[model samples]
Target: MESVRLNNGVEMPLVGLGTFKVRGYEAVYLVLDAALRHGYRSFDTASVYQNEADVGRVLKELLPKHGLSRTDVFITSKLAPRDHGAGAEAGCLRSLEALDCQYLDLYLVHWPGKQGCKSEDPGNPGWRQQSWEAMEGLYGSGRFRALGVSNYTEGHLRELLAKCRVKPAVLQVEYHPFLVQSQLLAFCRASGIHLQAYSSLGTGCLVAEPTVAGLAHSYGRTPAQVLLRWALQQGIGVIPKSTHPERIAQNAQLFDFHLAEEDMQALSGLHSDTRYCWDPRHVV
Candidate 1:
């Protein structure tokens, strides 16, 4: 698998398995087992995903079967919104215990505000900062290899940068051809933060788009591969999820092909500011 070095100098695979709605023991096990067998070295999960324990158990049982160890793969989990302030450290510890690992390869603030709090809540900023401090402490203790945030906007990042003791190393967001965040991407690039794309397939909706289909036809590749390659070509790490064994193996086939510049432009042209996930810009 191709990897990128984060600001903290940790190597992270560009492609990983995303377990967002993927739950239960059998489901996680089957998908993770397929991913491991197909050369995926990273797995992304979160407290809100509600399957940390299932993921941990599956990995523990599957790693040895594939002749791998804990150090061989990267595991990333996020701090829940409910854990935004004083609950940060404990939430992180819960992930560690649930994943059955000594430390996490990467940990992120899942949202910019506390759960159940309004987006413009006056306390959001303070809560988020407090969470970062807690995360920094975890980083200091070597429990978190690197710290970052997900679903953060440029404003959210700027605010964090202004007061953070440790800079965020990665920013994961919902990025795809139809929702290109040019300014946010540029900011992250300038700030030395690696941009990781989740929902790269537009939550599986992009695969059926006519333009994407045409591009897939021209490239003789699956639409999913076309979409994932668009992100990989831009130096962004992507986590594409699928339960099918064939699709799991197919998504990993991205390393062999490169998207042409014009083709990339074509993909970029599809950007319409359409978002299939939560919008965090309003979170103060």
Candidate 2:
């Protein structure tokens, strides 16, 4: 798989397997096995996903079978919303323990606010700062190869940039043709923070969209592949989730083809500011 070098000099795979709702030993095992066989070298999970142990255990078993080791693949996990502020360190530690790894290749602050707090809660910024401090400590200690934030808008990122001792290396967000996030992308590019796309298929809605289907037909690719290739063409990393073995294999077939410039623009024209995942815009 292709990779992009982070601001901190760590390389992150352009494509990764997202384990959002994937759970259970057998399920994770089967999906991961198929992913490994199909050339996926990056795996994304989070504390709240409740499947870190399953992913870790399954990887430990599968890596040898694939003739690979821990360092051969990039592992990313996030700190949960409930673990914001003073709980940050413990949260990262728990993820490490659960994944049974010495360190995470990328560790992200999953959201901008605490779990139960209101979206505009005045205390949110302070909590975010506190969390970043602890995360920086972990990064300095080598527990995290890189530090990042997810679902942060430009405002949130500017706030962090103003006070952070160590800059964020990546920002993962819900990005697809419908939710293009062009301004945010420009800002991240200027600030040297790599933008990664989660929910690249717009929670599976875009896969069935007329525009996407038309393009998929023209390219002789699945709707999912067309959608993923759109993001990859722009240098954004993507973690598309799937439990079906054939779909998992098909999703990794993105690197073999490139979309024409006009076709890329056509996909970008579908932007309607639509978001199918959690909206963190109102989080103070």
RMSD of each: 0.7, 0.6
Candidate 1 clashes between residue pairs 3 or more apart in a chain or in different chains: none
lDDT of 2 by residue, 1-284 (tens): 99999998999999999999999999999999999999999999999999999999999999999999999999999999999999999999999999999999999999999999998899999999999999999999999999999999999999999999999999999999999999999999999999999999988899999999999999999999999999999999999999999999999999999999999999999999998989998898
- Local lDDT at 4 for model 1: 96
> Can you write out model 1's per-residue Cα lDDT over 1-284, one digit (the tens) per residue?
99999998999999999999999999999999999999999999999999999999999999999999999999999999999888888998999999999999999999999999898899999999999999999899999999999999999999999999999999999999999999999999999999999999998899999989999999999999999999999999999999999999999999888888999999999999999999888888
Model 2 error, position 31 (Å): 0.6
Question: What overall lDDT goes with each candidate model?
Answer: 0.95, 0.96
Q: Indicate which candidate wins on lDDT.
A: 2
Weakest 10 consecutive residues, lDDT, candidate 1?
A: 83-92
